[model samples]
Target: MTAKYPNKEHVTYATFLSSNRREKVDGVEIGTQFTKVVVNHPLQENEELVRPMKHCKTIGDVHSEGTSIAWPSICIQKING
Candidate 1:
């Protein structure tokens, strides 16, 4: 898909709901934890496949990774504490 924000980066939400071809004692198959971010909005058919989002909260590890500014002290405290 193409869009105005083709270069803008963001995260999308997806879930592994079911597996059709798998043999288990309980007849259940575990799915994947992989989530892919789409540069453009997902198609109509992919709407139910994943939940898309524009943003998410930053975590505390950002500072430990050697970044000058992760977030404000108060913001980090509010999130981490």
Candidate 2:
């Protein structure tokens, strides 16, 4: 998704299933779920946004082939888990 900043900066995201109960995909849930997204020591000049409360995306402004709750490729489209 192209962001409204600059001429045109497509702000893609790395989706993930962090404790969020999304639809059953093809992979199994692993490790610990994500809770808080820690910010740098000094706030950078970048916009940090979670896709949505339902389907949460990890970091914005990234470019990937998209993921799911199965693969857990860094994956969530459901509400609370």
All models, RMSD in angstroms: 17.3, 13.1
Candidate 2 residue lDDT tens string, 13-81 = 223334445333333323343322222121222433333223433332222223332222232223254
What residue pairs clash in candidate 1, if any at all? Answer: none
lDDT of 1 by residue, 1-44 (tens): 11122322222212222223231212222223221212222222
Top TM-score: which candidate number?
2
Error of 2 at 72 (Å): 8.0
Candidate 1 lands at a TM-score of: 0.16
Off by over 4 Å in 1: 1-32, 39-41, 49-81
Off by over 4 Å in 2: 1-12, 15-17, 20-25, 33-81
Model 2, global lDDT? 0.30
- The local distance difference test score of each candidate is 0.21, 0.30
Output the lDDT of residue 59, model 1: 19
- Please report the candidate that would top lDDT against the real structure: 2
